[model samples]
Target: MENLTATNLYSFYGKSPVLQGVSFDLKPGEFLSVLGRNGVGKTTLLKSIMGLTDRCEGDLKFGETDLLKCSTPQRSLKGIAYIPQGREIIPRFTVRENILMGTFARPDGKRDIPDYLFDMFPILREFISRRGGDLSGGQQQQLAIARALAMDPKILILDEPTEGIQPNIVKQIEDAIIQLNRERGLGVILVEQNVPFARAASDRFLVLDKGRVVLNGTSAELTDSVVEEHLTF
Candidate 1:
């Protein structure tokens, strides 16, 4: 696993800057959560890291390679697997096909889905032949994660993995995330609204407001008062 660093990062959507002087780091195998209310550039932060924004400036380095100069596919090849909000899996594709898509980002050019992927989410194995759109929201979320994992990423970047998932399955998703971090040694950058889950799963946390980081510290310091002040809507 490698480290990710973003210094004085600014991302723009057309003429407007959505991320202003954002700076943070994700050390090897560490889990960092991005926290904020609606429209505070939380999602934008993830997109900026992935090279999906209209324009970006400042240093974003994954290990020794500079990310700002890399294209979107180049960045993905460098081991950052991004699962954006809304679990954008191909509706017409079978579960197997969807998972296979992740391998396109591999620099090795290998196309096989790793066995660890099915091990992480057995339901994906059970429904290997099913169409992606036929699954429930929770299942789709799992498929989204599984697809990202199929890339064999060094760091998994998730945007609200539990959003709209059934309550019964929320814990399962949470546990899978922690397992990927602790057992498999994958670094994670999570953008989530659930205060309890973020506080529970993260090593450190950052709170963004109107495109700037306002609060950042160890997860132990992300107290209820901090949530009430910066995260609660």
Candidate 2:
């Protein structure tokens, strides 16, 4: 149960800053939803947490360890798994191979895909030998999540997981996320535009506007009015 904390966090791309003075505390196994309209730094927030920005300044820590002191790879190695928005599956790699790639971040250096991943998303098991690029968008998203889970991370950062995914499987993905949180005690920081799902899945929510946190509260406070004011574009 590691706690991820960010204080006065700033992230830059080239000369411009995308995240400014961002701060939050995510407790072990807490489900947090990062909500915002398009291009309000929701993705960048996740990137900063993952150390994907060119430059970052502030205090980011997992438990007692400082994340700002760690490299991108080191962050993952320390139990932070990031599943970026595009579901960046390797085009030439097989599903199994793509999933195996995530195991490289394991501190134990274990390479086997966790058996639970297949049980969560059985389609991945069915297409174990198929090329990652050949899968449908929903399937690819599932694969991306499976790959991250294969790393056996303590926390997962997901960006727009259900976007562009089919409605049927969207429910499946959402269920898997909630199941992971409730049953497996997986801490999740999810960036999602789907308000209903966010409200349903998150224990807490943060509303980011133009790179800063303008509003935050328990899930019960994320009403339609808040969504209209901050989350709706």
lDDT of residue 199 for candidate 2: 94
Q: In angstroms, how far off is 211's CA in candidate 2?
A: 1.0
- Candidate 1 RMSD computed on C-alpha atoms after optimal superposition onto the true structure: 0.9
Residue 23 local lDDT, model 2: 95
lDDT of each: 0.93, 0.93
Off by over 4 Å in 1: none
Residues 42-126 of candidate 1: C-alpha lDDT, one tens digit per residue: 9999999999999999999998999999998999999999998899999999999999999998888899988987887889999
Give the lowest summed-lDDT range of ten residues in model 1. Answer: 113-122
Q: What TM-score does model 1 achieve against the real structure?
A: 0.98
lDDT of 2 by residue, 38-149 (tens): 8889999999988889999988999999888889999999999999989999989999999999999999989989999999999999999999999999999999999999
The residue ranges of model 2 lying beyond 4 angstroms of the native Cα positions read none
